[model samples]
Target: MTKPAYIAITQHTKNSKPALVYVPTRKHAGLTALDLCAYSSVEGGVAPFLLGSEDEMDAFTRGVQDETLKNTLKCGVGYLHQGLSELDQELVTNLFLSGRIQVCVASSTMCWGRLLPVHLVVVMGTQYYDGRENARKDYRIADLLQMMGHANRPLQDNSGKCVILCHAPRKEYYKRFLYEAFPVESNLHHFLHDRMNAEVVAGVVENKQDAVDYLTWTFMYRRLTKNPNYYNLQGVSHRHLSDHLSELVETVLNDQVWADFR
Candidate 1:
């Protein structure tokens, strides 16, 4: 992955376009950034990925607290993870967008929340271990898409590219998912009863119609017609949707949680 990332860094740097690399964890983000930096360094010293003059590089690292991070930045590499302060995240992000940084390696959970003008994006790995689940989970489909999406810069470049590194068995899986449009479905129904109970207690919802009406204002309601079968609906008519919601409301009101409200 780093070999490809190294190639991307070298190529994109020549075009004056930023590149992005997505890793699975905070530790991976830092290490990958430094590894890429070293790949382009001169005689074991940080030499590639750096931007601007010595004085400018000196000023860039002056207030940065992490010594390794400071050095990485001098090499024009930045790492971001969920642990960073909001201000620090913003600083690194701004630098990347403004061409002050050549490459940024970020963890899956650390989305920069901005449209990047990068020409290359690399997904170093496809799975991360989840402590709570006690297992390794594939990167969420949406997250993988978002990470890859950064390779494009609408007006900045004529084209963009993304390299995805995953286990051999999962290559087909990613090819199918990434090349196809993955639909995003709402999960609001999973916790609708709890939410309905709260609104009922707060006098925001009174009966079945009120509950159904409340759902109409939610994203799930908007998707009813689009994915009626996913929600277990036999028909996609307004009446059918209303009947389902009414049934749901009745069921919720009978649950142990809503007993007191009734």
Candidate 2:
């Protein structure tokens, strides 16, 4: 018997319709977008026009200092990232959503909440930069799932595809992470201090008890409580929580209060 081209479905559901397209990096995204444009032009006919007016597209093309990227845009390919101006990002996103652009080379920033119902989603890399660690690390299961969710739009198409491309060493890891449906781990502990401080500064919470009570109602709290063993936070003492809360209170109280002199 001949072997199959791809592996058998491990954990896919009827509702999970996104085709995950994974590449290695932002550079790969660009290359892949160009390749897609080339293929589409040859197989699918002329490329669609960009979303904006000719003048707007011209300005955008000129504004891009990267000559190669500018030329790519002419081929109906675009990229999205925080580095681009808000207008540029919006234009690219709109173009992709309208199907005016064949492919969009985007960073993970596009994966959050923006709804671009594309037939395919290509994840360039499985690892993202970890600011805390000052190094690139594998994406968490939640983030990987969230990115894939962007591609699976049942309203537009009953099914979509997400392709993930990773290095050979990391291929098995990606397979396990995607095929096994790993549970999402919470990062509240990493952001707890910053969140409390911001809440105190914004006047969202007044006291330590208020902070604790407020957190208890959040989804993170509920999830963590339910899976304490997996999270390993069962031993988080009240004293530690109180200390962090008290520090937040002090910082907020000490800050200069803005007032209207009038």
Q: Top model by lDDT, which number?
A: 1
- Candidate 2, residues 88-147, lDDT tens digits: the string is 667666656655545566666556646666556656667777679899888777778787
* Model 2 CA lDDT for position 84: 60
Q: In candidate 1, where is summed lDDT lowest over 10 consecutive residues?
A: 42-51
TM-score of every prediction relative to native: 0.68, 0.51
Error of 2 at 87 (Å): 1.5
Which stretches of candidate 1 lie above 4 Å from their native place?
11-14, 42-46, 85-87, 112-115, 181-262
lDDT of 1 at 20: 84
lDDT of 1 at 221: 85
**Candidate 1, 1-262: lDDT as tens digits:** 7877787566655655788888999999888988887787853255556655667868767877777788788878888887776766777887788787778888887655656658888888889999997999998877887887787878678888888888999999888885687777888889987798789889989877888889889999888889988888879887898788888777877784566666
Question: Candidate 1's C-alpha lDDT?
Answer: 0.79
In terms of TM-score, the best-performing candidate is 1
